[model samples]
Target: MSESKSYTGGCACGAVTYRIDGDPMAVRQCWCRHCQKLSTGGPTHNAFFMADAIAVDGTLASNAHAADSGNELSWYFCASCGTQLFGASSARPQMRAVRLGSLDQAHELQPTAAIWVQEAPGWVRIDPAMEQHPAQPPAPPPQNQS
Candidate 1:
């Protein structure tokens, strides 16, 4: 098993902060239209974690939208700096999709897959090693209950 590590980070303006304990569930790059719109450069790098593993502080604003995966997605961000934070999906209430860029060690969480490749622009190149999906990939089975 991969060694568990803790992470801490915040918004650009320093108004919001968060901490994540232990390893995340999954990490991936999202190229969906919504993600593209939300991204500053290109694909949105996302790291998924159980809600209980995250601890956040400060004010945030959120917008709920229907995700391509047929889940209701609530995107949360720092209200002051407009920095995207994490996305909460109703379909997976226990899961929180955090914006990898907001992590202090964002580079450590590399994506293993790319989703919504069909919506990516022609200029975008999908990584050869990462699994690619045209749309929403099949979700893994829910975590085993202890």
Candidate 2:
């Protein structure tokens, strides 16, 4: 069998670092207002992976709030530099969304879908090739058990 891919990244101030031992289940660009605010007016790119596949090596600060979809969302960041690292939704507790920008520059992941597009700003231009969802989509399929 082929070896699973590994990815490593850290917060801007180097106060937080993480490693993932498997491939992402999905990568998406989220245009939800909450995500926009976190991204400073742009969409947040994230790669979703099984929570069990990730290992974090630093203390992280986090905030939790109810999202428009009514899911309890929690975001983790670096306390020193405030760089967003990961986001988790109560709806999918077994998964974690890792901010694409927080990953090492060499990582090749890309958003294949754009979600919550109805809330995107008028001036924003989403790639036409990506799958679009006007609001929250169904959860990604569960990881294989093998």
- What TM-score goes with each of the models? 0.90, 0.95
Clashing pairs for model 2 are none
The positional error of residue 93 in candidate 1, measured at the CA in angstroms, is: 1.1
For candidate 2, write residues 15-56 as lDDT tens digits. 899999999989999999999999999999999999999999
Q: Model 2, which residues run further than 4 Å from truth? A: none
CA lDDT of each prediction against the hidden true structure: 0.86, 0.93
Q: Per-residue error at 40 for model 1, in Å? A: 3.7
Q: What lDDT is reached at residue 25 by model 2?
A: 89
> Which candidate number has the best lDDT?
2
Candidate 1 has a TM-score of 0.90
Please provide, for model 1 over 79-134, each residue's C-alpha lDDT reduced to its tens digit, 9 standing for 90 to 100. Answer: 99899999888888888888898997645788999988999999988888999999
